[model samples]
Target: MSETILEELFIKRSQQKRKASPLNYKERWFVLTQDKLSYYDYDLNKAKRKSLRGFVELEKIKCVETVQPEPNSPPERSYAFQVIYDEGPLYVFAKNDATRGEWIKKLKEKVRFNKDLIQKYHPCFWADGMWQCCQQQVKEAVGCKVLEHKNGVGFSSKNSSRRRPSRKPLPPTPEEEKPGCRPLPPQPPEEPSHSVGMTVIAEYGYTPVTPQDLELRKDEEYTILEMTDANWWKARDNTGREGYIPSNYVVNAGNGLERFDWYCKNMNRSQAENLLRTENKDGGFLVRDSSKAGKYTVSVFTKGGGESSGNSRHYNICTTQQGQFYLAEKHYFNSIPDLINYHQHNAAGMVSRLKYMVSNRAQPPSTAGLGYGIWEIDPLHLKTIRELGNGQFGVVKYGTWMGQHDVAIKMIKEGSMSEDDFIEEAKIMMKLRHENLVQLYGVCTKQRPIYIVTEFLCNGCLLTYLREGQTQHPTTIQLLEMCKDVTEGMAYLESQQYIHRDLAARNCLVDANGTVKVTDFGLSRYVLDDEYTSSAGSKFPIRWSPPEVLLFCRFSSKSDVWAYGVLMWEVYTMGSLPYQRLNNTEIADQVPRGLRLYRPQLANERIYSIMNRCWHDKPDERPTFQELVVIVQDLLYELQ
Candidate 1:
C-alpha cells in the first residue's frame, strides 16, 4: 500500500472501437500511478513526452480474472483476461497464457484497494481540459464539459450511494467446480503474399516487449519482411508474426548445410576470441577470416595447470601483410602445417591439447602397440644421480635406468597432473622417433613418483654446453654442423605436423659426439591443423620469440625459424645471448620495428645470409626447416 507504484512495462493489448469491430492488438506503454492505471502509445523517439491513450481510476475496479474466449471475441484472442468494474468489464488479451496469468495477478492486487476510494471518486475522461466522453464538440472550447448527465445524475456525492446489482458470481478458484471453459479454435492460415524466403539459421529466443515478434527456433522458416540493417532484419515467422531478429540468425535455406569456415566469416575479432576462450576452455582452437584480405586468424586456447597453474593464455595464429602464419606471434611458419608441427613438440605455454586431437572424446590411438623404441625400466634399478633441472610438468634428474642405461628421468610431481593427462602426453612422445630428437625409453605410471625415461646427453643442454665450451673455440664448420642437426630434427617434426613451441638452443641437448638433439616436450602439442593458440596470459620465452610472438602471442614453425636465426647467432658468437644489451621488455618493444641482432663476427656472409632468411618479417618469406638443412649442409661442405 505504498503511495508510489512499483514498475512500468510495455505490452500489447487488444483494442476495439465497437462491439462488432475486429480486435487489434497494438503495442502500448502501461503505467501504474498512485491513484490510477493508465496506458499510452509509445513514441518512436523516447525523449518526447508520451500522449495518454486511456486510463481507469483504481476506485472503480471490483475484481479481475483470467477469461475464456467469448462468442463475440476474435479466434486469436484466446489468451485474455477481464477487469471487472462498476461501469463495465475491460477485456485485455495477452500473447500467451503465461502473460494472461501475470496480468490477472497484478490487477487483483489493485482491485482490493479500489473499494475504499469509490465513494468520493467520479469516472471522467479529460482531453483539452474537458471531459471528452461526456462533452459535445464545440469550436474553441477550453473549460470543463457539462457536469450533469442526461439522466440527471450529477458528478457529486449526492447520488454516489446508489449501487447497481452484481453482474455474476466471481470466477471460481482452482479448487471449485469448473464449467463452460471450451478450448480455443484453430488460428487462420498465414498470409503468403509477404513471404521473402528466408529461414532461421540458428536458434534465437524473442526477448523484446512486443508479442508480435516471433522466436527464431533452429531450422524454422522465416521470410524477410525488411532488412533493418546489415545485422538486423524484420522477418515474418511461419505463424505470420513479424518482428526484428539478428540477420546472422537466418540465412538462405537453399545454401544447404553450412561449413565451419562459413560460421566464422564476418565475425568481430573480440567476439571470435571470446568464443574460442569459452568454448575451448579445456584446450581448443578456432579458425576465422582475418581483417586482412585473403588471410585468416587462428585462435589457440590453452588452459594452464600443473606447475604453470593460473598461467592460461590465448595465442593467435595469423598471417601478416606479407602472408606468414605465426603462433603467439613469436614463431613464424611458411604454412599452417608447419606451425602445428611445432606445437607437437611444445605444450608448455598453453592448455592441454586433448580436444584438438579430434571432434570427439575418444583418446588418441594408443601407443602401446606402436614400435616407438619405448623401454619399460624398473624403478628399483634406476639410481638417482642428481637433479638436472626443474620443469612445469615434473623434475628432471640424471639417473641410471636398469642399473646400466644412462638416462634423464623426468619424475612428474604428485598432483601436478592427473594420471590420464600424463599417460596422454607419454603416448604422444612414444609415437615420435628421429635421429636428432630425444628418444623416449618408457614411462613409470604404477609408482607414486611417475618417471618419463629418455636418453641422456653427456654434454647437457646446447646453451649450457656452448657457454661452458667457449674457451674451446669451436670452428665455424663445427657451429654450422650443430645448426644443421637442429634443423634436421625440426624438419622431421614439421613433416609430422608437430610444432616445437619452445625451440630455443636451451631446449636442444648436445651429446658427447658433438651432435645436437631436440629435447623437452613440455611445451609441445599435437595439433591437427597448422595453428595452435595458447590460452591468454600463458608464460613464454620472450627473448626467443619473434616480433609477432612478442606483440600478439602467435606461434608457428616460421616463428621457430625466427628463433633458429637467434640460435645461429648464439652459435657463431660462442653462446652470446641475442639482444644482449636489452631486457625482455625492451626486446619485445624493439623487435617489431625492424631491430635485429647484429651479425656474428665469425659468421661468414653465406652463413649470415641463411640466418637472415629465417628472420624475415613475413613467415612465408622464411625458408622451411628442410630448406635450412640443405643450406646449412652446403655451408658446412664449403668449410670442409
Candidate 2:
C-alpha cells in the first residue's frame, strides 16, 4: 500500500485456466504497488472495480517473466506475462509488447530486494494442468530452463517430470535428514524460438553410457535445450550441435561450489576456528568462502602428539591464471573440491592431514519455499507416515513429500486456531533460514485439513536427547558446544529483530550428527502471545519464560535470553524438569521476586556466571544474543 507504480487493464487467465483445453481468460483492472500486485473485476458500465479478485505479495514472488505463446494460440492473448509466486503462477496479458515490457520492468525493480528470487523459470504457457514446454504435470515442479534477469529468458521441453514409478512405503530409515537420490526423467520437448536455453558448465567428464548419451567434457559450457529427466538432459554444444548428456556431469555455470559436504558457503575465519576447535577432532577440516573476492580458505584441526594438542591451521586454495587450482605448487587440480580431496589424504606441506571432512551441511537449511516458488503444497503429495508427537495445535507426524522428500507434517486441527491469520503469518515465517533453526518447508491449504510441512530432525527433541541419549557423561566441552549451537541460532533471530518467545530444551531438536536446532518460531499468531491469560484450559511453557513474559506477557529477545538460561540449566541437569515440584502459580509468583535457578553441579564458576548474566533483574541488563555468542564461544575455546 505504499505507492501505485502502474495501473492498467490486463487480460488475465483464471487460476484453473490450465484445466481446460481452450483456456479461460478474462479482462481485469490490475494495480501494481510497492508491496503487492492486485487484480480486480471491473464494472464496465460504472467504469470502476466491482469486486476485488486477487492479490500477490511482491516479496513472496520468485520469478516474473513473459510467457511464450503456445502453438495455435489466440491473437488477443499473444502478449502475455507471468508472475510466479509460492506454489503457483499468475498469467497476465498486455495488449502489446511495449505495455508488457513496461510492466515487467517496474515489477523487476520492485522485487529486486526479494531474498528468494529464482534463477530459472518456465517460458511456455500451461495447459491441461501441465507445462506446454516441459510437459511437467506438477504445477509446482522446478523449471526446466534457466533465467536471465533482464529479459527473464527461460526454456522448455517435450515431456516433463520423468519421475520414478510410485513404489511401496519406504522403510523409515534412521539416516537423519538424508535426501534420496533422484531418478532420470521421462522426456523434454524444446524451448520457444524467441527464448534462450538453460546454460550449464560441465563439472566432470563422462563417457557415453548409451548410444543416445553424449560424451561430457569438463569445463565446457552447454545450452540445455531440454531436461528429459532427472538424469539425462538434451544439450547443445558450442558448435550448435545437440545431443543427450548426463545431468550430473554439468552444473549451473557458477553453482559448482554448491554441491559439496565439506564446503561452508558463508563462514568467516573466526567461525571456522570456533567450529574446528569445538569439534575437538584430531583431523577435522572444512572449506569456507574467503574474505578476499573469488577465493577460498581451508581450515584443519590437528592434535600434536603428547606435547600439545588441539591446534588448527588454515590455508588458502590458490588459483593460477590458467584456471587450474592447487593448495600447494605442482599439485594443481581442476577444481576446489579436487584440491581438498587430494589434501584429505595427504598433508604434503602444512599441518596434519585434512582428515575428517567437517561441515553443517548435514542439516542444510530449507529454501524459503519448496521447489521453485511453491509455498502452498499440494495435499495429494503429502503422506502421513506415523505420529511423532501430540501438541496444542494437533499431532505432528513423520511424512513424505511426493514420495521422495522426508518432511515433518504438523496437522492443524480444524477450528482449533484462527486459520486465515496463521496462513498469512506462515508466509513470513517461511522466509527465515538458519542452520540452527528448524525450517518450515511449505503449507497445505487447499484441503479440509491443513498441514504445516517442516524440516525433520532424526533424533527428536533435545530434552529427550539429553536424557535418553547413550552418552550420559558428556564432557564439559561437549555441553558448552551444545549451548553454543542453540546460541548461534538465537543470535541470528536477534539480528533479524525476531523473538523466539519460547526457548527451551523441549523445543530444541537434535539431528543425527548431534546438532541442536531451534524450532516453533513465528507461530505467535494462534500461539501463546501477550493476549493469553494462561487459564486452566491453556497449556504453555511458563517455566522457561522470563518474568517479563510471565507477569506482563511482554516478549522480546531479552525474554528469549532469559529462557536460554533456564534451558541451559535443563541441559546441565540432564533434562530435569524446571522448577521441579513447584506449580505454575509458584513460578509466576517467585520468578519476579528474583528467584533464579541454581547452578548445576557440572557447571563450574565460569559457566554459572554466564547463566547468571542472562537472569538479570532488568531485561535490558541481560546480554544480547550476539554478545552471548561471543561469551559462550570464549568459554568453549577455554574448555577445548
Candidate 3:
C-alpha cells in the first residue's frame, strides 16, 4: 500500500478514537445551515491525523460567517466543515489551514461520501425545531420542508397538505335551559320572578336539554336552582356518570339559590371585585350598582353536577368602600373575616391598606409610619405632582422631593386601623439595604393623609425603558449586568434572611446610568417568620413567583432564586410579563412540572444553563442567590 493510503487510514483511526475521549479543545468551528448542525469528530489532513492517535482537536477555525445553535441546547463542542464549490452542494472540507495536496485529497473523499448520501440524507439546517426529528423525517420521506411546531419539528410535503378538521357545532338548546341540550320548539322566553311559590317541582337525574326547552328544564327539574355563567365555564363528566357540560350550563330558576350565602356573609363582594379588577380578570361577576360606583364578586360558582348531588361552589367578591369592586376567593372572606371586616367596617384600616400600595401593586413599598405618611406629604407637592397611575390605595404622582429633587409621591387616604401590616412591612424594610435596592428616603405624616418618600429613579422602570421605542435596544451585556445586579442585591438580602418575595423588572427601577434598584418590600417576609401561610394572588407576584411559593405558600432563599430567574427572563424579553400566556394555576403547575420559558434571541448556552438551574422544579435544586451572582458575573465577563 502507498504511504499516503497508510497515513490516511491512521488519521481516520485516530479521529475515531478521539470521539470517545473526554479531552477539551481550545475552540471549535460551527457552520451555519438551514437545519441544525450536530457534530462528529473527523480529520481533514494526513499530517496531524497520522501523528496523533486521537482527534486533532480542530482549533483556530473560529469566527465564521454565521453560526447559531439550538435555543436551549448544550454548547457546540466540535468543528463543522463549510464547502465552497460551483457543483451541486457537497460536504467537501475547506482548505483553511492545510495545503492543497493534503486538503484537496481529504476534501475529495468527503465530497464523494456526501454526494453518495445526497440521494438519501440531506444536510440539516438550524431551523425552527429539534435537530434530530428533522433528520429522521428526511431519512424516512422523499419530499420534506422543515416547519416549526410549538413542541418540536414538523416535516411536511405537498402530499401532506390535507386541511385540518373543523370544530363541531354545539347542539342547539333553549336560551333559559342548559346550553347543550337538544333544541325544543320555539317559545317565548319567560321572565323569572323573585316571589316564593307553593308550586312543587320534581328533581330528576341529569338530562341534556336544548335552549328551546329552557322553560321545561326550569319547571320540570328541582325547585332549588343553581346559577352559573356560560362564558367562564369548565366542563366535566360527573364521576363518569353525569354527562359532560360547561359549568355555566345551569341557570338559577329563581333567586332561591343559597350557594352565595357563605361568600356574602364573610366578605363584601363589592370590595373583592374591586381588588380582583385591580389585578386579575379570571374570576368574578360584575354587579351593577345605582347608589355605589361598581360591585364585583370574587366568587365563581359551579352548579351541582356529576356524582356529587349536593355540591355548589360560591366565591366572595372584594371591592373598595368607594364602590370599586374586587374579586377574591370566597374563603378569603370567610377565613380572614376580621381583616376584611376591619377594612370594610372601619375607614382607618381601609386607608392603611391603600397606603402600602403606592409604588405598584406588584411592588408596594414598606410602610413604616402607616397612613400617617400620606398625611405628612406636603400639599404643595401634591398640587404640583402629576398623576401617573391609580389603584385601590391611591394615586402615584410624579413630583419634587424637598421642593427640588425629581421624585414620585405616593399618597394614601388614611384608614381606620392603627398599625398592623404597615408596622410589619416597616420592620422588614428597615433591615434590608443594598446598592441595587431603592433607598427609602423618609416618611411624611404631618398632613391630613400619609405619603412615602423614596429616591425617584429618572429612568422609571426596566419596563418603561424597554417600551419607549419600536423595538427595545438594550444590549446583551446590559441585560447580563442587570441580572448580576439583581442577584447581588438579592444575595445580600438572602444572607440577612429576608425574601424579596416579588422580584420582577417592573418592581426594579433603572437609573439614568442603567443601574437597577430593587424596590417593593410590601410582600417581603423574613426567612423563618411563620406568620402567614395563605396563597392569595395579592401575597405573591403570581407571574414571577416560583411554583413552591404559590402552591405551598412557603418561601426561602430558593424561592427568591426562582423569582430572580423570572426577572432574568423579563430583562431578556425587554420587560414582557412572565407566564403571560399561562394562567395562574397553569403557571403554578408548569414551573413545578419543569416547564419554563426559553427566549431564542437572548438564550445563549451559558445563560440558558444558568436560567435552567435557577428554575429547577425542586426548590432545593435551585441555586442560592450567591451562586446566581457568580453565574451571572461569569456570563457578563464572557460576553465582554
What are the Cα lDDT values of the candidates? 0.56, 0.72, 0.41
Model 2 agreement with the true structure over 1-640: per-residue lDDT tens digits: 3678899998888777344536578889999986779999997898897688999988667788889986777888889999987647899989999999999988888777554465447888777767898775656545656563423322232222333323332222121112332211222122222223877877666555335556667678888887634345678889877777755456676546755668776565556777788788888999886543246788888887743458778787765534678887899998887787788788878687788878764433444445433579988888888999976667999988878677999898776666777787676667666768998888999886789999889889998898985445787766776788898788877665466766888789987666688998646436534344221223446787777777766666778888899888888888888788788888888989988888898888677777887887777557667666656754553343
Best by TM-score: 2
- Sort order, TM-score high to low: 2, 3, 1
TM-score of 3: 0.40
Return the candidate ranking by lDDT, descending.
2, 1, 3
Residue 505 shift from truth in candidate 3, angstroms: 1.1
Write model 3 residue lDDT over 1-640, tens digit each, in one string: 1122212121110121222544233222222222212223334553222222222211111111111222463333112232222121122222232432444334333233121111112233322222342332111121122112101112232223322123232122112123233211111112243222222222212233222122213223223222232111222222322222222223343333212222221122223333334533222222221111122222321222333222212222343312233333222333233433433333231212211111111212222211211223445544336776653335667776545455666665455223335533543354344557775544456664556566677777766766563234656665676777677677666655455666777778876545677876433432113333222244456777666666777665677787788778877777677667777778777777767887636666666667766776766556566555544543443353
Residue-wise lDDT of candidate 1 within 586-626, one digit each (tens)?
87788898888888998977677677778877665566675
True lDDT of residue 365, candidate 1: 15
> RMSD to the native, candidate 2?
22.7
Best by lDDT: 2
Alpha-carbon RMSD, each predicted model:
32.8, 22.7, 28.1
lDDT of 1 at 371: 22
